[model samples]
Target: FMDNSKNMDIDYKKARTFLDAGLTYPTGLGLGLKIKVNGNYAVNLKFNGKADLNAIMNNPRNAHFAFQFVPSGSLELASTLAVDADVVESGVKVSANLHSSTGTDLTVKVLDGYGVDVKLGLPVKKQEILNFHSDVFSVIREKTGSEVETPVKFNVKREDHGGCFDQLNTLTGLTVCGEVSVPLDGFKVLSPAYGPSKASLRIEKEDESLTAYHFRAFYDNKQPDKLSLEVLLDTPNSKTDRKFLLTAKGSMKPQKQLLIVMESPLTVPTTFEAVVIDTELEQAIAAKLTSDTAAYFIKIGAHISGDINRRKYEPILEYKFPETAALSDKGWIGRKGVKGGRQQQQSAVGISGAIYVEKNPGTAYRQYELQSVTLNTPNIKVTVDGTITIDANLIATDLKASYEKDTLTLNSKIQKLGERKYIARVDILPSKYP
Candidate 1:
């Protein structure tokens, strides 16, 4: 029954009716009807599925919410909201593709034999800001029911550029605890080739009492060389919280010298100390020369000070030799086929020097000046002063060595053989006196 009047009222005490009808109404349904009938009424209604009751009540505009329903004992609901996520468990993996607005794609994978609790969500519309809570790690641990045992790999790619990283925004509030092992192959493109098989990174950021981030990386390999790096940022207890320290232990030869380049001025104390193989005095003065047997007892210390913009370096270097017993008994430094008796034992050597480097804007090389470099031994004392220039991986030195009543001019050029390998050729000329 249809009514065209503005107001209609129908009253029924007991009625049973089964009706199936489709209705198309205006925004406000411009009519009012009162129903007082009640009893087993089965009515199936279908709308355009774009009608919204809230929109029609607030504003009789074109707003809509399409609605269609069938009366049934069991009903199922479905949604089309897209989500990006990944999970790894018990050798089974599940992941979803990520959508990036900037055309850059990122893939994060947890390597095999490991598990991770990764949660991600994106809004229906793009937003600029992303915030993370301080307890994110804890939340992840709680969800996974255990700590992560392997590293989470990150691969970022850009269609327009070719590099390890491109157009990536900075992420904040990220705290990682426990140990995470990262493969060295992931950073093969970086400079100063990494020789370590793996790098283990550890960070302590869960402690609320500490305001700084304590991070450390241990680079380990089967070779004799080993490295450990530590960094502390925003530490409150120290005078300078931004501290970086690197310590290495390995053989000498190619790895004899440590080079540190700073892009900005450092306000904290930065030091480098290494325990390396001891090349005899001859090998120490000339790189190409080597002893038959080498010992790992030379202690080198260097305090680096310089900034790249200024192009000037002034570092203090000091070398401490091992005890005479170890040097002589162990044959750490000796001439070939020379049998040393008790009276022919060798004496310990001590060296202390400073190096100054200045780069000219017009020149393609930098000059290192050795100032007041003294080498003292029980047999002889020598003073060295020289200017060394390095260009295209070639190191050339013009220096004067004075000992006793003789003054010698030393000219040497060191050539690189391979990775962490070098050979120095020296030509020593002496001036004759009556």
Candidate 2:
């Protein structure tokens, strides 16, 4: 008899024992013994030879015991029980399967097996793992030509502690570094006019408190028919508004160049400048520069082609004012006068008609014969029809100026005496239709 009690009361005389011996007591004898505790016992055995046992003894208090066993090449037994007791509260509880394990799995839980389940040794397939090289190469081939064989090298590191905030005590950080190549020829299908080029991209964080960053993208090409473009983005002082800048330059043909620059700021208006130059002609054929609050100026300059006489007689020309002028309801206005006096005059006058230029016989000076030109000032609603001749510094005209319901005919000769000084002789006929 085996007992763990300090006191025992039993009658040996009343005890009985029985046994049976088989196989004539010579060949074989079989014996079996079974014992059970009075508390709670749970045993789960599977056909694959895995065993799970959970037992709770009710002596003195609740005591838990559990274990799991799996028969495999790597034999391992795992405990599936956890005991928590509080002496001050005098609380007792029994929990089963608080932890479990098998040949390829181990799981643990707390708080009566309903909280914080942590699992380990979970099965994973090969396909579930990421293939870095293959994926990167596939993307590169898709962007570039399929014949590309560039090697991609990268590394990944896991940091145990990265960043933290309130209520979050642990953080994991993953850092990746790599490089990818992009062929410029791949984009030819999108824009055939662009020459062979290479592009570079850069990005940088400017501030930690604000969402401000600096970005730049540049594209460059070879010489002769060269092209280049750059873009920039930033915040001026980590406090001001964001700003963006773009500049583009291209030289397509001989002696021809193009330049463009644009700037945009969140607090102020945008500004831009564009120019197209022909170095052979030593001029810009078309140019523009302006801002939102500034005066806009545009000029188009070109050389007149064809017969010399026709070029001189029927020339097309453009003119630009030296000073910036403001556009108003009454047309462009010049600078304001001093002390509120008369406003300075401003005009953009264009003239086109048949005109002749001839050299005076035995004289170094030339004469200009204006055959027919009609000048009109739409803002003032006045029209002038004139035939004039300019010889040396003298201009002689016989012209008619017509206004609303009035026409005046004048025959005049004006001679320039000095800068801003002129002497004139005029004969004005009475108003014809006043």
Candidate 3:
């Protein structure tokens, strides 16, 4: 048996030989193996009678995307039914629940090996459950006793590496209540390249308090040089005093640097901190080296600053003015992005400065709020060699904006707010070049 797997090192690289005496040998050489990839779909072929077969997927090459149509008067109700069956040597657990605006309290557990621990539904003040029971390999639950033997059904969707890891983590979370130790043998067996995946999901509810936490870890083999170990934790509930945090920590072997992100629901967070270890500093001084034929000179300096607490970036630019012998007027252009309405958000040109900072900042204030920007100075004659862009909302009244060579078109709109009141909104929507 030979592996036509993607791993180049493990691929059989031997030759089949048939010779004198007992030298006759079976096919030993691995040949005619190629992997065809198109977008997310991949197929591996080894050109042999015995080959791994997989399901085929449909492609919508000529189909246009559209939303699924739902009738106006029709109503769709979905339920969650999880049936876990166990063989004679193994045990399984089945669970089912119906969701409401509040939450779901129904669950079914089936134990075949040790003993049966059946829970139809946890008694809630107002919630009701039918009945639940499990046989050797099936669990039935419904509103009456006649449905005991009738197996429950539900659909499950999954990704290649996404859903299985979630299931494993949930199992681990159920077993780990307090300080629990895990041995190497307890982990599922995996190849060295694609090994080491663990996850845990935990939830606790009591009276008006509820808490949920999910932990996931998996190997990320995308970055060849950097061994990427994805570690993530999300706890959205604030029932505990420890503060709510959604953490996506990078857990890798080198441990050179780990960006453990602790993000709340809002930007401009209340507080933040960082501890630097094995810092590597890099500095460069840019100097102007004038060409022998050149007569004019220019100098520039740049500085970068960031605020972790607010997650804000402020860039400041100061430059040494070059010789202005023939230059008269000089002006600077600035662009500032404010909150926008639906029109602004869906406009051709998007000018969002910090949309990620706030928790879904209102679209009303997310528009262009430009008081003014200087396009020309008193002495300098500004003739931009290339095309220049300026938002009509930010342009000063006196500044004239016209293209030099290209017929720059503007997508402008005028709206009236009230009687004898109007506002001009203009933007250069990007489209195919003329």
Candidate 4:
């Protein structure tokens, strides 16, 4: 009977060693010796060796088995023996076939079976396999304008252990500061059931050096089916290294080897200077500019047009001239705080009119049309009527005025009143009303 138990442990040990040496399974090892007796007879001896599975596994070599035969007693043997190896080799072809769950494609080869020309029984259609890689590769390619096929070289040291983060949420109510770069700025990946929508930026920079990363998706109803990406590169020593903030909503399909699509808003790298809190004087100036009574009133009104964020506006203003009541609620034309009878009469005789603003499509300064009215004494009848034009700087040009049929008529006049403010006036009598 064969001594299977005696060397079983040894074979296992050797196999373990081979496994440690990176050799595959089912490897064999043995030792034998032969002695020549006269010319045609010989004595053979054999012994099985230990199998170190651990060693074979650790090694990078392919796993294999070895066997030896020896004659202990007197035996006669021929110098040459006819051995047909092809048939046996064809039947004993050692190989394996790997199948993937996803549709990813992969190619695998059997080491020993290669030279032997073994046949692989692969499925009619196979899934593809995605090559494992680090995320930095994609980021570096965009940031440095390097091609995707750029030869990148990196080594993992002995001290480095393999690690992974399955799902990360990098942008949870996070704030950005200083220079920062994000490769997947606007990638939107939608779930199979949910509709398409925009994707949010998943990475964020808290301070100058601190950064937080996340893999959470922004939940939305109108997710886009197509994929989108945005790359942010914050250059070193950039002047915009101040209080920065960004709000993005973006999506990701996790199907293996499948194309991932993301959606996001246009990535415009813009910096906003810190809003400097105005001193007491600055606040006072702003208040004075918009406060009541800061503006003057006349029969001729002022035309106003400029860029404002809101679409709705209702300005409440109070006029200061004493005779303004006549031009406004009361029927009188006199300046406020006018002392003496002559001065009061002169203030009452001052010009009064209405203002009109005409905005030029896509132009900076709007056209201002002012209607002024210097009431005739005794009856206090209307008199002047006209229009004026101004540029973006509120510069008045083409100034002309004419009194037609007892009514004032003015031509387009462009004039700069202030940075954005403009002024135009006209006079009109009841007969001129149209």
Highest lDDT, which number?
Answer: 2
2 against 3, candidate with superior lDDT: 2
C-alpha TM-scores of all predictions? 0.23, 0.28, 0.16, 0.15
lDDT of 3: 0.26
Distance from true position, residue 153, model 3, in Å? Answer: 20
C-alpha positional error of residue 265 in candidate 1 after TM-score superposition, expressed in Å: 52
Between the candidate structures 1 and 4, which one is better when assessed by TM-score?
A: 1
Q: Which candidate is the best by TM-score?
A: 2
TM-score of 1: 0.23
Report every candidate's CA lDDT: 0.36, 0.38, 0.26, 0.28
Compose the digit string of candidate 2's lDDT tens values, residues 1-434: 12312222322211112222222112122321211112222223222111122222222122222222231111111111111121111111111111121222333322232122222321211111111111122111222234233322334321122221222111101122222222234544233122211221211122333322345555667566878676765533445445567777877676455666677654344344444555332233544444555545444443332343323343233333336454344322323457534332334554344444555565545545554443435444455565566676788877776677687787888898999999999988858633
- CA RMSD for every model? 27.5, 33.5, 30.9, 30.3
State the lDDT of candidate 3 residue by residue for 270-356, as single tens digits. 221121222122111222212222222121221222332212221122122244222113222111245321122121212222111
Question: Model 1: residues >4 Å from true position, as ranges?
Answer: 1-298, 309-348, 360-363, 391-397, 410-429
lDDT, candidate 1, residue 279? 30
Candidate 4 lDDT over 1-434, as tens digits, reads: 13342243211111111111111223233211211111222223343433344534554243333322221222221111111232221111111112112111121222332211111111212112211112211111232343232222323211222232223213222232222112222331112111111212122322333221112222223444423222222212322332222333222332111112222222224321111112221111111011122223332222223354211111112233433333334422333444422122233343445444556467665554545544433435554444444455444443334344443333433345667766654433233654
Clashing pairs in 2: none
TM-score of 3: 0.16
